[model samples]
Target: MQTVASESGSTLRNYASILLLLGGICLGSLVGFIFGNKVEGVKFIGDIFLNLLFTAIIPLVFFTIASSIANLQKTERLGKLFGIVAGVFLLTVLISAAVMAGVMLLFPIDQGNTLRTIAAQALIDNPASAHQALTPSAGASLTQVLTVNDFFELMARKNMLALILISLLVGFATLRAGEKGKAFAQFLDSANEVMKQLLAMIMKIAPLGLGAYFAYQVGVFGPQLLGVYVHPLALYYATCAAYFVIFFSLYAYFAAGRLGLSIFWKNNLTPALTAIGTCSSIATIPANLLAAEKMQIPDYVRNIVIPLGAPIHKDGSSMSSIIKLALLFAMFGKDFSAPEMLLAIMGITVIVSVVEGGIPNGGYIGEVFAITAFGFPMEQALPVAMVIGTLVDPIATLLNANGDLVSAMMVTRIVEGKDWLSSRLNK
Candidate 1:
């Protein structure tokens, strides 16, 4: 009885922060519904919070990735970790794409007249948006995406993929430096710790920051959630929720039976909330890192996987890609069921999921790629895809951010064995 009481108290303590965040977000949402655009004033508070996270992200990612690799006892471990991470990322993305595609088949997303209305309104709001060309050439070149000509360009968040590549190279260099690199590796570790502390400090205001952000989102975009978008958005939100509950549970169980599932769901709330509130996988990295730590995921795995996943691994985007394709096909009166079309959709989904978050304006680039690939007129189709993308951004980000944590768990299990969680807890 005493142990039960103690455990209950501990559980309450563990959930206290989540409760506060939830309450703040709910209250802010209420205010938004009441005051509408008047709540835009509060968005600046959220921006300040987001900016702090953004400012810290490049350095944080560099330190975490570099330190994790630099301290690896064997270079072979790096290879194994990378291989597992890539495999898991690809598998999960394919699963999500298939899931969304299946959902679309069961209940096709037809925009009907709503497409024209929404498109017209979008064009009215931004007269130049329809004229804007998001051609493949507009996207970062392969060389530009992976390697910045000026080292200073790597410091920008828009060049995150380049930043990650540079970090890997630096880590490999440090590892190869042997005894001479010990001090530098220690410095990387120390810097990583400092970044973690900075993130924690920024998160202290998350309730307020996230609340304000939610208010802004609801106030500005709440009305747009109606009409033609209602069906597709409903499908997306419901699908994401199902995927979050169902597939993530299966993943956790796969990682370590019931224990993994319990731990993952228990620690997932904060990251989920942060992701939804910020609508950014990059911004939610700090919360995901904290959750990973609480789940007892190995430091090296979480450190490397979560940061890398932010830029590249996007189950949410993969799912969204299929839905976007379905919606576009519906609008253009194309047969989405053709085998060649399905294959192209799947391939594009993988590319968009892998590439979207890594480059500047990548989401738009992916949408444009889909539009042009399907032979849709860019002027008409681009606006529709962008609208859908914006409406689903919050839930999509929730999946993308939290997916990284679970991916870390799976990576740990494969690298550290089936008993990884139990062994860590026992220690």
Candidate 2:
């Protein structure tokens, strides 16, 4: 009974902390909106918070990936693990795009004329910039990603995939190194622990950091930001909420029926809320890790899947891409009924979703894909699309972060059998 009471109290505290952070976001946004430019000085707090998060990213990725890979190698299910993760990831992306497309059709953004006028004025004001933005540059990003010409460049946040590849290679090598493999794995595990501790220390300041950032965003963008794009923004948020509830519930059911559904909601609530506050899936890693620990997921599965899923399992971002493209089509007066256009929209959205984690303001960068692939007039269409991304990023991130944890749960069930959760509870 004492143990039960203690567990309840801890759970309550965790839930409270998440709510408090959310409250901070509301309060900060309100204050910033009210004060606007007058709150410029307060922007530093948000900047510092973001900087701290960025600072932690590399160490977190390296240690977590290396340690996870090493542990999984010992299990010899590494190949099967990757195959399952990839299959689930692809299925989610397709589902996200399909759901988003259907929702947009139902609650379509009907502000086409207003959006067109706004873009026309932007084009008139900055024709040169618009021209440059509109030019096709399809292979530039891919080339840069593949070149690896500069070693120092590979370590940047945007090059996390590169780091991950390197880490996997090193991890596998370490695994094959015999007794030395054990010591190396232990070292990496210790590093992961150190990084986790560091992240916890950083997260102690999350509410303030997240609040400051939201305030700064509101101040910069102004109180009327959401009002200006209310139609699309509201629709996007609503659709994402539906996606989270409907799709994730279905996923939970498929993964473990009633018990999985129960565990999914219970484990994901705090991390989902945290992701909403931070608007960065990477920022929610520590919280997700904590949730996985509480859920009794084995460390190897948790570390391998959650970190990799952060980048690859981007169902929410994929949905956002479709939403953005739909809005752009409406804005530009394009006929969406064309089969080719629909295929282009879905294809580019999936591609953008694949690298969403690497791009800064991924929601915004996804607009670039619109410009290049879907033939949106860059100057006029990009700004409107950016507004949508900014407005919808938090909810999208919440879904993405929650999806990562659920993927962990699903993967654990696959690897450990359907009774995984029940067995953990019994133990």
Candidate 3:
């Protein structure tokens, strides 16, 4: 009875905390809607919060990943963990692409003349600037994307993929080192704990920080949501929300039955809000980690999966890539439903979700690839696609970031067995 009462009290407090965070965001959104651009004043506060999270994430990712890997009882477990992670990522991306493609078939996203007019007007206004902006670079070499010439470059958040790779290598090296590496392994664990504490301290202000950020987001970009991009945005946003509610719940239940579903929804709101509010998967890592911990995911699974998933396992981007391609096909009068085109779009979605996802403005490469592949004029179609990417980014990030948590749960289920959640709860 005492335990039940304590559990009830804890659940209530958790809900209350979630309400406070939601209240802050709601209030900020209200301020933005009320004040419009005047809400810019508070953006600096949000920036400060973001800066602190960004600052801590580099070391946080490094230490947590390295520690998780180095401390694994068996090297075979590491390989198995990654194998399962890769499988889950691929399966989810395929599902996302297929779902979005089906939606496009049912209700085609036709920007009609509106997007073309907007693109042409922009080009006319500044032909040189528009061309320069829309033109894709040769695209970064795989070498450049995966590694840095200088070690210090890995410290930047943009190079998170590189950091994760290096962390894995270091962990493997430490694991191979055996007893000689014990001290360093201990150091990594200690540092990881410290970084977790630092992240907690930073997140204590998330309500304020996220509130201000959302204010700027709504105040500045809210108006833009209604223009030429409205139809596609509406479709994309609705699809993402539906995917989040239905598919993610299904994933949670698959991971561990009814208890898993309940725990996931209860713990997911804060991370979901963080993802939408911050609009960066990397930025939401800390919050996702916290939520995963609450879900009682093993440290090794959550730590490795969350950080690694930030770069590669993007279900949201998979959906967005398909939407962008469909939008372009609609604008250009291409038959989007052609068998070859759908197959090609699914292939590209996988590439965009995995390859371009980590690189800065990497979506440009995917968009340019889609445009060139489909024979659309880059100057016109690229601008329209870019606008769609920007508008859907927040919600996309919501799916991208939160998807990692559920993936982690699923990974835990596979690695630790279907009884994993039950065992944790029993403990």
Candidate 4:
């Protein structure tokens, strides 16, 4: 198991594999563009890959979370670990919100611009359709989201929120079960191991699957998506990159003291690139777990904090929310200069970022959340929200996943000490 784990952690070798996958994607896209009709059949290869990854997500999350928490019951620092992770999550969101607000203020989105008009017209013409399109399918029915019958429904990814809750409850119960619970915990640990082995197998084919998917996606969407919205997309990417480097770097430095940066980059790069391709933090958990393992993060910290962090620690969504809110207000010609409005935006954005699901166009649902919660003018903001949400969701996913690994390291460092990496090295 350790050998398999280390093989998964070979960051330098992962880079080479990543580059080859990237090449395949580029070549596939070029071919798909020139002969989309001929290459259309290859999309199923990508679907197969995603389906395989999806198969492991629920079980991996459940066993990993429950087992990690149960293990923490033996330690005195479970509360401290939770506190540090929560604190890091909150601090990162605040930093993201502040930086995003400042950036929007500096290079304010042009309200009357063509993209805004296109967004406004789409919403104005068919508001309901736009709403249906942007609203996440998973979030559409709160009843379904909250209530689940049978184990299968509970294990479904759409019900991940409930799964996490159930896992936490089970973990606490197991902690209190004493000797009998020890066997159950061992079962869960074995289950987690099975899932990790499954993950290693899945990753072996990820490059092929991801490449095909990217090719199909780019071929289908084409350059028109970017060509039309280059300005805003460019700004979004630039700021996102800045946030990852600056905010994430600071968090790493604080967490690990001197070796923070080195520890982060070496272990983090492949996962960041993986996030870019997967565009779903939930899907990236396998890779994130592997990277955390490679970083020598304590097992308890890696398992518990990383999964929890996926939903809660969202630097990317925070960054994108500010951009979406700022642009929406700009589109509606509202006065964001008011302190109350700014405060409202900040508060709502933080909430949305944390609760937002890790699904395609999930951030658009967040825009809808902002409009409903804060009573923003939906008719005007909806179109702009949809546009920004679609464009920035991938970048947001990148930040979201990358932040998970970083948060794992930081929490590990705080709970374990700064010399954790060096200790592993000296061994």
Q: What value of lDDT does candidate 1 attain over all alpha carbons?
A: 0.75
User: What tens-digit string does per-residue lDDT give for candidate 1 at 1-427?
Assistant: 9998985676566445556666766677778888998998898887786567556656766786788779766436678778899899999999999999889889996656655454454456446544432222234356865688898898765566677678888998999999999999999989978876776676567668767766875686664434555777889989999999999999999998899999999999999987876667887899999999999998999998999899789999988888888876775556677776777688778866764564433465467556644545544565456556756776888889989999999999999999999988999
CA lDDT of 139 in candidate 1? 40
lDDT of 2 by residue, 38-84 (tens): 87788678667656756775676677667766876544667888788
TM-score of each: 0.59, 0.60, 0.58, 0.57
Candidate 3 segments whose C-alpha is farther than 4 A from its true place = 1-77, 111-227
Q: Global lDDT of each model?
A: 0.75, 0.70, 0.75, 0.68
Per-residue CA lDDT of candidate 3, range 348-395, in tens? Answer: 678557644544444544565555444455445654565567557777
Sort by TM-score, best first: what order? 2, 1, 3, 4
Candidate 4 lDDT, 23-66, residue by residue in tens = 66557667667765566577788768657766766676677668
* RMSD of each predicted structure: 9.4, 8.5, 10.1, 9.9
Of candidates 3 and 1, the better by TM-score: 1
Question: Which ranges in model 1 have alpha carbons more than 4 Å from their true place?
Answer: 1-77, 111-226
